[model samples]
Structure formats: structure tokens, C-alpha cells
Target: MIDAEITFRKLEIFLCYMQEETISRAANQLGISSVSVHRALHSLEEGMRCPLFTHKGRNLVPLPQAHRLAEHATEVLSKMHQGIDETRQIAGIGQGRVRIGTLYSLTLDTVPKLLMGLKLRRSELEVDLTMGSNSDLLHQLEHQKLHAILISVTDSDVDQHQYEVLPLFEDDIFLAAPKLSTLSDRHSVDLRSLKNEHFVSLNEGFATYHGFQEAFKIAGFAPKIVTRVNDIFSMVNLVQAGVGYTLLPGRLIHAYRDSIRILSLSSDYQMRQTIALVYAHNQQLDPNLLALVAEGRMYARRRSEKR
Candidate 1:
């Protein structure tokens, strides 16, 4: 008993109502008469056999059911757009390439592994990968320069309405020091013990930089920052040379463990980084990007299962 007559027009009206929050406002935005807007909603309600809104004096407030419907409506519309784009591509009128963005820290392994996974499946797929800071990547995504991004959820403030997010992994920050250091001999490094320690950190806009700032805040003292570098690998190089200790994610430490010792923080000082794959929710997903997403999901699952 599904509603076969639920037209795209009706769904568009529904989404417009969700955005504008009123019949008149929705109507105004759609450039349609108030009566037509009302009729469309009424028809949709009849088709679904459910009320999407509740009247409150002069205002029409969306019910919880309406919010739920909005999610479906968005997916339906997005899929419809994808269908059209795919149709055009199949007709030999459109290009097929996926532009992916990532933060600098992922360059060491995650991005390369993902690209390898993507290329292994489809050698014909064209993949364009760009690396930047977290905010820079998000900005590129917003400007349509990139179709997808991988970033730390703890450091990103992405708008959920505009993007689909897939959480990847839980990474904890570790204090990275020289391999033969006294701090490495500790069972757990106390943050207060390093009040006067020199620190090497990534410049602002990096997720690790924010994590570094958070660790200091928890320690209740400003770290004696010796130098702010642009990338985590460079900071690792600095730490290995005994220039200073730096905070880094477990992944980075795991990669360079032979050269550095990553110490765990004591109680009330541990913070975690949640990495995620984000892409535009409203666009037609490119086939290659779709493959990358699938691989990323599988990678996340395996990583989670191992832990």
C-alpha cells in the first residue's frame, strides 16, 4: 500500500517546508501560490495517509514524523539526481572522475592505501587526490573543488545537512619523544611532569594541532612550543632528532615506532580522535568515489573488529 502518486513536486514542497518552516514561506521560495503549496502538502499527506505537520495558532509545526520523512525525501531526491547524472554519463556526454581531499597526516598511509584499494578494483577509474589542512579540505568540499574528504571528526565542525559522514577510526593522541628518552621509560607519562618540556607542534588548522592544544589545556599549562611546523611527518622528524617532544595520533606513532617512543597519558588527560569520510549528501556520487567509500567502510569495519 505504498503511495505511487507521490510526485517529485510534492517531495520538493515537503523539503522546502522543512527548510522554510511554513506554508507561506515555502510557497514564496518555490514561486507558487499559497493555495497550490497547501494543496501539494495536503495531497502528500493523503498519499502517505499520515500528518506531517501540526497546527499551532498561525504556524504549522513539523512533527517528528515530518523530520523522519525529510531524511527519506532527501535521499530520494539525491538518488534521482544521481540517476540523471549517471544516465548522462552512460550516454557519453559527461566525464567520470572523482576529486578527493584529505588532511596532511593521512598522506603517510591512509590515503595511499585507499587509493591503492580504489585502483586495484578499477584501473580505468581516474582519481584526483589533494591534501590540505582540515579546514582547507572542508572549504574545498564546500566550493565543489573536491567530491569527498577524510578528516578528524573531533576537529571538524561539518554541517550534517550538507554532507554524508562515515566515521572511520578512533585514534588516541600519544606523547612522542626520542626513542632512548627517560620519558619513554615511564609506565605512563604524567602531564605535570613535563610542564617545562619543549614541544614541537603542527601549525593551526591541523587536527593534530588542535589535539595538541587540547592536551595542553588538560595539563593546565601552556606548553613551551619550540617551533610550529606544517605537517606531522616533519614534527616526527623533529622529535626523532631530539629537537622536542610532540603530540601525535597512534597511527603516526605506529608508523614510526622504531624511531620514536609514544607514551600514554595518565588519568583525566586522555583525548581521542575520530576520523571520518565525508562527501556531499546532495550530489550524484561518482562511481570511483563510490568505490573508495565502500573500501573505506570495509577498512573501518576491519579496523574496528581488530580493536
Candidate 2:
């Protein structure tokens, strides 16, 4: 076992002295006094419990043990540096990968556009995506399982003190039904008129679920619910099969244009979702997150311009 007194710093100074072949020159290379260099070498020799040098008049001559120690010390320091770099990469620091979470519905447009833009800006960066409900994503982000999340902030109680939020865009919720439904001909849907309709809804904790509840509250009656699904795609599938009516965000319209009919909500029950990128405030300066924030800003600008 090595003595605790023999430190990485001492090893570094020893290596420099071995290369420079003189105390004054090693000190010059390391920006320290010659006495400090000599003292470090002496302390290192004492820690090793072996003679590393022989004094030849004013010069210190390296023994064979010193040469062997230098070789091993170089390998140890190199490995240490490699380990630190790998750890930092895995932590999403300094040009490392970023893990992003989003709602299943965003996969159709918002997520694709943002990720594509991110790729263009950071070609070497690795992006991992996990899709879930708004609440699940927020929970994962809070637990440090995700580097950032793209989600609806309007429905979530996002603590401003804990997170940095960058608003992406507002999505209007529309009444969605089977393609051939009679409601397709209507310009706008009033929730009160649909009180007798059986609806399929997303489960609680989803962003859209809050909107669903709010719209019904304004209508003053709860519509019969056929079922509650966990994901938007499943809800859309049920709607397409004519199981029941559902609400959808405008961003998902293009993906099911032929399978479902989307109509604007009447002013009395109109609901809009504000989507944003959310991450821990402490990680605001991380390089991977910085890239994500820049990409989010660009995406928001493009969405605004298109509107």
C-alpha cells in the first residue's frame, strides 16, 4: 500500500523534476520556487520509504527506482484524468449528451422540430428522449432522471424557485371526433351541447386532463366518460374507432387529419395549453442544457413566425 502522504501533487512535481533534470528548471516550468520543488521531492522520497535520488555534489541524480515510479505515476494520472472526463460526460456537463422528456403528443411535430434543430446546432451531441404525461416528466426532472423536459406548463404547478422555464408556444385545444361525425360540420363546439356524449379522456396528472376537467366545469355538467387512457395516442385511437369524443391540441391535428375531425371550442369552454422547456435552475449553465435552451428559443421563434 502507498503512504497517504504521497499525493498526486507530489507525483506531478516529481515528474516535472525528472524531466527538467534540475530543481530551478522544474520550478520555472511549474511556476514555483526551486525550494518548493526540492521540498516536494524530499517529501515524496520519504513517503515512498526509498531513496529516489543520489546527491552528486550540487546535483541530484535519479536512482532506477525513481524512473520506475515516474512511469507508473504517469499512467495513474492519465487514468485519473480519463475517469474524471467520463464522469462529467455522463453527468451532462460540457458538450455531453442531454436527456429530454416530452408528452407523447409532441412526438408528431413540436418534439421533432426541436430535436432536428438541436441536431443541426450540435451535430456531435447525443440526445435521449423519453415520452410520458406532464406530471411524470416533471417528477422525473425533479428527481434528476431527466436533463430537461418539454411539457405543458399551464396546467402544472411548476415552482418558479426550483426550475427555469422557457415558454415554447401556446396550443389551442380543440374538440375531436370521428371523421364522419355530424359534429364535423360545426364551426365550433360548445361543451354544453355534448353533455350526453360519452368521452374518452386522458388519465389524471396529464396536462390535457386538467383542461378536460375545466371545460366540463364551465359546461356545469360532467359528460359520461367511456374510459381514461394514459397516453394521447391511445385516446386518439379510441376516438378514431368511434368509441367516444376527445379533446386534442392543434399540434397533433396533422397526424390524424384523415382519421379524426377537429373543431375549435366555443369561447365559453376554450382552453389553451402553454408548452415550455423546464429544467433545474442550478443546471441552467450546463453546456448540454445551454444547447437545449438555445434550440428551444429558436423553435419558439419559428412557431411564432408561422403563426
Candidate 3:
């Protein structure tokens, strides 16, 4: 039976002693005291039930048996280190699946590029994605249904305790109107300018709607909201129909440029929303999660620099 106390360190010292052929030299190479190296060599020899080395005056020379064991020891240590590296890679902290939730606005460009970059760097990893409203996605994140979530920040209810948030980018809100509307010819228009016109808006829980309300208040008029829709696509569709005008992210205008005309906001009260990626505070230490957060921060910085 093998003695449990015969450790890998002993084997390493044994191999070092064989290579250096001197306890003092081997200890120097290993950054260990000579006494400790000598103890390890003797312990390994005892465990193997054989004398592994012969003393040549002050120098130690390896026996035939010791040379054979040293060869095998090198292979064994190499395999052991390889196993450790592969295991770490499989733990998702190095190379494993990351489930992410994002808002629809981000799905336009930045999120896809980030995912593509992650995939290129770690080909073995799998990414699962979900898109929804900030509130819905945050709820899923709280329930541990997702590894991380990217969402637009809002004035609505938020739970500060459960998540670790990193603010990424801010998108200005633009006024999207029908292609032939009078508002389309203007370079910029305040919310008050659209007070008499019909307005399309997102439903109650959306961050865009809240931003619109704030913009309206700043313009000194409560908007005459004629329609409330669920998603940006529907809101944009309503604006395209000549039914009304709506506030949307600048990114969204670029995405659906063919469908509607985007106009800049005139007042100093420009509406904007901050986007961020959030994860559980406890999971921050997870190697895979930490790597993803680092990648996200890098991606955000790069995109911000381009702006």
C-alpha cells in the first residue's frame, strides 16, 4: 500500500535532486532549504523501500533506480498539471456556459459583438441569451435564472441589495415621427412643440415611457398620449403610420432608419437612459462570471471611446 504522506512535493524534490546531482544545488533551484530537500529525498526513498541516491563526497549522485523513477516522475507531474488546467477550464469560470439576459435595445449591435468576441476567445464555451424588459430580466436575475443581465436603468422600482451593477453606456432619446410630418423638417423640437399632436408611447413598466414622461414634464406640458404599446417595434410602427410621434433611443433610430424619421430633441432636457450589466454579488467571485464582467467592461470602454 502507498503511504498517504508520500506527497507530490517529495516526488518533485526527488526529480530535482536527480537533475542537479547535489542536495544544496537542487534546494537552491527549488528555492527550498537544503535540509527540507534532503528530508523529502529520504522520505521518498523510504516510501519506495529503496536507497535512491549515493553520496559522492559532498555531492549526491542518483542510483539507476532513482534515474528511472525520475523519468516517470516528470511525466506524472506534467499530467497532473495538465489535469488541473483542464478542470479549471471546464468550471465555467474559465471555459463554460454563460446565460445572459438583455434588453431589446442592446440586441441591435453591442450585445451581439460582445458575444461574438467572447466566443472567439473561448470556443469551448456556450452562451445562452434571453431578451426582455428591465423589470422582467431583473426578476429573472434575482431568481438565479440567468448568470448576468444587461438592462437600461430606470427611475422605476429596483432592488439594490441583490445585484452588482456596472453602468455601461447612455443612449439619448430621439423623437421618431412619420416621414412626411412637419416635425421631420425641423432639426430639433421640444416636447412642447408636440403637445397638440398625438403621441405614441411604450406601456407603463418600460424605461422609455418614464423617460418620455420626464421629458414632457421638463417641456412644461403633459403629453397627449394617444397610444400605449408593448415594445419599441410596435411603437415605431405606430409612429410610421402617421398616427403620432414617439420617443426612442438614438440607437433604435439607426436600427429602423428606413421605417421612421428621427429628430433631435431641442430642449436642454434631453432624455437619456443608462445601460448596465448586473449579476448577483455573491457570484462575482466565480471565475467564469468574473471573466465575463471583465470582458463586458472592456467592451463598454471600447464602444464609449468610439463615440
The estimated TM-scores of all candidates read 0.69, 0.71, 0.67
Writing each residue's lDDT as its tens digit, candidate 1 over 2-88 gives 686589989998899889988899989999998898888888888888897888997778889989999999999999989987885
Which stretches of model 3 miss by more than 4 angstroms?
1-95, 154-161, 184-186
Residue 40 C-alpha lDDT in model 1? 89
Best by TM-score: 2
Q: Is candidate 1 or candidate 2 better by lDDT?
A: 2
Q: On a 0 to 1 TM-score scale, where does candidate 3 land against the true structure? A: 0.67
How displaced is residue 20 in candidate 1, in Å? 46
Question: Any residue pairs clashing in model 2, and if so which?
Answer: none
Higher-TM-score candidate among 2 and 3?
2
RMSD from true fold, candidate 3? 7.2
By lDDT, the candidates rank as 2, 1, 3
**Model 2 residue 22 lDDT score:** 94
lDDT of 3 by residue, 28-142 (tens): 9999999999888888888888888788887777889988988888999999989977875554344468889987778888788778777766777788899777778888887
Candidate 1, which segments miss by more than 4 Å at Cα?
Answer: 1-94
